[model samples]
Target: MKLEPFLLEILVCPQCRAPLNEADYDGHPELVCTAADCGLAYPVRDGIPVLLVDEARRPV
Candidate 1:
């Protein structure tokens, strides 16, 4: 599912509170932290952002 532009604008990283950028993770669209050190990818399920840190995926 696709996230709305307005929602994307308000979403931020849970770890660093940094701004998130639109990205693709595991063939699914997600909101990835912009901070290079905090590479957390928050999944978008059913067009809703799963912002929980425990549910976040870190880049290898």
Candidate 2:
């Protein structure tokens, strides 16, 4: 599911507080951190962003 534009604009990485960009990962929607140093990918489950740092996927 796609997130609302306003919600996407206000959402930031919980770890680094960087702006997040929407992306498709493994056929699922996700919010990916834009910071080079902290590129965490947070899952978007059922149109709700799971911003927990522990639940974020570390950049490879």
On lDDT, the leading prediction is: 2
- State in Å the error of residue 58, model 2: 0.6
Q: What is the lDDT of candidate 1?
A: 0.86
Would you list the C-alpha lDDT of every candidate in the order shown?
A: 0.86, 0.91
Where is model 2 poorest over a 10-residue stretch in terms of lDDT?
1-10
Best by TM-score: 2
Q: What is the C-alpha RMSD of each candidate to the true structure, in Å?
A: 1.3, 0.8
Candidate 1: residue 57 Cα off by (Å): 0.3
lDDT per residue, candidate 2, 1-60, as tens digits? Answer: 777889889999988899999999889888999999999999989878899999999888
Candidate 1 on 1-53: residue-level lDDT in tens? 56677877888898998998888866898888999999899888877788999
Candidate 2 RMSD computed on C-alpha atoms after optimal superposition onto the true structure? 0.8
Estimate candidate 1's RMSD in Å. Answer: 1.3
Clash pairs, model 1 backbone:
none
- Candidate 1: stretches off by over 4 Å: none
